[model samples]
Target: MSTEERLIESARALLWERGYTGTSPKAIQQRAGAGQGSMYHHFSGKPDLALAAIRRTAEEMRAEAEEQFSAPGTAVDRIGAYLRRERDVLRGCPIGRLTQDPDVMADPVLRAPVDETLAWLRGRLAEVLEEGCERGELVGAPDPRAVAATIVATLQGGYVLARAADSVQPFEQAVAGLLDFLAARVPTDHE
Candidate 1:
């Protein structure tokens, strides 16, 4: 791979592991096997490199989620398919992981990708919820926005809980609980 592409790919992995605050330019360069000058040539600084990495990861995430969204099934089935997809739960969502980083959250340019990705994801989820309600798969208040936010929050929080406990169990349990709650909201044929 080209030095610039390698640098970005290496940076993406490190950023996901150490976050923007914890990852250093030197570490990224070494991981990419690129010289300091090579890195600087490709990126103005750590923030610039990180921004590129975040943007790429965000795009990848959105595409993956979209796969589940467009797949054949009820909205609940599709959402459940998404929630149950294989994940490095302990490492967390690369996009979601950025939300916990003070440095990334502080800069508009650096933070925009993270914010936009999550916002779009929540909107996607909300769209699915709205569709399910329209199709009579779900019932009640029909607050798709709030439900979407909750789903995202639950996932982000699940990662936190799982990481703290050093196991994917909490993450799995959280999804289970959410699926159960959503299932309970499924309407009876008469209702």
Candidate 2:
């Protein structure tokens, strides 16, 4: 990879491990196997490099979500597919983890990608919920936005639970429980 590419990938890895507050330009430089001058040539500083890495992570996650959302099936099926998508349960949500880092949350420019990415995802899930209602698959007056928020929270919290327990079972159980509820609550017409 090019020096810039290497730097960004290294940033992603480091950010995932150490978060915004814990990572530094020098550390990133060392991890990338690039010199300080080279890193500076490509990025203004640590924050700038972090912005690129965060944006990349958001895009990657959004793409995966879209893949599941686009599949042929009811909203529940699509969402279930997404909930069950392969994940490193113990690693937690990369973007969500940033929210815990003071530095990341403090920087407006740095937080934009993370905020927008999550907002877009919640909106997309809400759209799916609305579609399900329209198709009569879900028979309830549920607020799509609220349901979407709950769904995302469940997944995000699932990761946290898994990481805390040092096991994937909690994550799997959380998703399974959420999916089961969503499936069981299938709206009935004229109820």
TM-score of 1: 0.95
- Specify the poorest-scoring 10-residue window by lDDT in model 1: 182-191
Return the TM-score for candidate 2, rounded to 2 decimals: 0.95
Off by over 4 Å in 1: none
Q: What lDDT is reached at residue 190 by model 1?
A: 28
**Per-residue lDDT of candidate 1, residues 71-143 (tens digit):** 9888789999999999999888889888889999999999899989999999999999999888888888348
Best-matching candidate per lDDT? 1
Clashing pairs in 2: 139-187
Q: Per model, state how many residue pairs clash.
A: 0, 1
